[model samples]
Target: MTFQNEEMRYEQLFRVTAKFHSTMDIDAVLEEVIHTLQDVYPSFSYTLFLAHDNTNHNVIPIKEIQHNVNGENPAVMQAFVTGFVQIEDRIAEKQSVLYAPLKGRQGIYGVLQINAHNAIIFPKSEIQFIELLANTAGNAFENAQLYQQSKQLIADLQLINDTSHRLNSNLRLTETMTFMSSQIKNSFGAMEVGFFMYSKDSLEVLLGSTPFFENGEGEEFVTFSLRKILKEKEPLFISDLHSDATFQNAIYRSMMSVPMVQGNEIIGVAIVLHESPYYFSFDKFKLLQSLIHHSSLAISNSILREELEKLVITDYLTKLYSRNHLEDMVQLSMETDAYGTFILVDIDDFKGINDTYGHQVGDEAIVQIANLIKDNIRDDDIGARWGGEELAIYLPRVDMQTGYAIAERLVERVATYSNPKITISCGIATWNKENKETFQSLFHRADNALYRAKQSGKNQVIASENRVC
Candidate 1:
């Protein structure tokens, strides 16, 4: 190499370094690097490709464009994986391709590829300069990537914080699930979103946005996906469900099922599906994992709240409405219905049965009578454990005759079905719109009738009419 050429190369290298250092923007830096390389060799075409995730060992190009060519060249990939400059000589083609790894302080960030139009010799000095330029560009690319990742982290944290606050704000479980599903679908632009509750007896799927194709087949696929995840107890992602033998007939191309894991147990599952293959990114999947992780706690709390409320209003032993709940129901029924029947029933000789067979058998008898009342009444009718050995039933929109018949039938059923041959004495009272009866007044009338029935005989039904049959 001549001193003149060496001095010229020195000037060119200084200019290229200064120009490349002018921008922190990665794309601008790459453009400058490629342009500078072109200035050094005008007959050559240059290309640059970078990895989507620097943490991932496998190098896959996030960007497809490379100079005028469309796809990644094997030589460029080889250079990137090897972390070296690969010189491929093709004498028959009369050209050589140069693939230079963009080496940063940590690792190779990408590859810088050059395709010469004709056979050319790269002096040792010029190759060293090219490598130096590639290294500079690689560092700049990494800096930009780190900056972007930090910004993304901030955004993701804000989203999670906002979502947690919204979800935990005293919403019903179904409402919370709906809100969560909508948030995920809208944020990710997903084709389908489903929130499901998993239990031994019940498997419920709440849909947020309908998919492009949904029918019986879609439902079957959802069930299959849910069962698969529950049995495996792991997250599932299928990029191409249609091609898989397990789901070849399904319409969805991509699916993601993430369990709502709380501690060691899975409380539920969150699912998102798309019509196209490879629709979700790793970042999106991470966000979902975080979303469900946080939401699971909220869901479990909501379910517990509902159960607590049920305990407050229902009798734990008989599974009947408690006295307070029945009174509330009576008030509500009076406001809605013009009239109704309130039947107060007492198990005949309940104390004797407890003394003879023990409290356990007494409880069994009560439960048996409660079940019969529950089974026989209309859904609008309310049955309650009014007090010890006493059960009450409120039938809305029923006349006195209907109320008497219902009470009489219940008396017969309890007597026949009970194990120890227990019988009941029932007091039937009717409420009318014109009477404007308060719940307390109606309850007193029924209670008086019940006392009269007990005074008269054990097993019988008596109406407020004092007509005992």
Candidate 2:
């Protein structure tokens, strides 16, 4: 009968060993280990502890046990430290304990402990079986850890590649900023995301998912963080803002500020904030650095594109529209208006001013007159530099009387407002359906009128005669 009982025990041990070897999942293996030990010793209490840096007292419990061992058991620590089995049988107290070290070929990983209500001694065969179980479970845990690390690395790489592809898709600057803000907020699970353009002169923020922070107490925290980042010109990761003496008044718990730099000059900052302290990980901070580096190139390109477009349509000296842009505006105005007025202005005796005060002062006089023209026109009206000493204005939906009044006002403003007491000669012409005039015809008539103004007397207004088809 004793031989039969030993055979049955060996069979059970063999089946439990098969369960350990079949799975590489650590949690599943731990569950199987707990059940197998209970089946073998039904009257014994069991506890499984995973090794944390090889310290028995600071181990992580694998499963909840009803028979609670409040602190570190001496026998369990002895077996784990020695990499061997420990047994204590106290027959007088009716208690026994067995400690088996869960060891792999590399090293010991944890401890498997058993407590029997009745004093009992484990045989050589049972001790060997428990050691085999520990070794198998240790290898399974190692495999699981390696798999998790590989998956995380893959995910990080994918995030970087995806952000690079999207940010380089020829978006405008405003659209690019908005897209970057949304991506960061969603990816990091942040409470507020803000993109701010920080330059030597100004601070402008484009906020996303921060309605509560737009004009509230949170705004003070956001402003303070941005100023600090700008001054430092380095990345800032605050795990706890409330505890930081530099920002004691700041209410938010945590934040990250990444400077968007181009060739050592920081043009902007990207900020992410959360309501809890220590919310972001180092891995996430590194990912954000990579993302901002990729986005900076796209943002710089967009800014250059905008500046280039402005140069194409604007006159460099006068800061007014070029002749070609003016012609386009006139054409567009003609298409949609019943009556359109055109005014041509020439700075009177401009060459005499240049000859007397030099070209620099003459330039100042021209700039002053251009300012008067710009100030007198509505936003929808067009102002352009036609040529040297020649400027033009286009006003749509205006009658001849209103057009003449505007031209008169410009002549008075230029003569009264310009330094060195300069004045301008103006000519007015109108286009209407009854006259059936083209833009060139209208411009020619206005030119003729300007010649008349110069001929009659300088600093005066002249209106061309209207001709019907």
Give the best candidate by lDDT.
Answer: 1
lDDT of 1 at 245: 80
How does model 1 score by TM-score? Answer: 0.69
lDDT of 1 by residue, 308-349 (tens): 999999999999999999999889989988999999999999
- Give the alpha carbon lDDT tens digit for every residue of 323-421 in model 2: 999898888877777888998999999999999999999888877877787888999888899999999999988877898898888888887778998
Which portions of model 1 miss their true places by more than 4 Å? Answer: 1-49, 53-74, 102-106, 118-140, 167-171, 188-245, 252-275, 332-341, 348-360, 377-381, 395-436, 448-469
Q: Looking at candidate 1, what is the lDDT of residue 28?
A: 63
For all predicted structures, in order, the TM-scores are 0.69, 0.64
Q: List the pairs of residues colliding in candidate 1.
A: none
Each prediction's whole-model lDDT (CA) = 0.79, 0.76
Error of 2 at 20 (Å): 9.2
With candidate 1 superimposed using the best TM-score fit, by how many Å does residue 13's alpha carbon deviate from the native?
A: 11
Q: lDDT of model 1 at residue 282?
A: 75
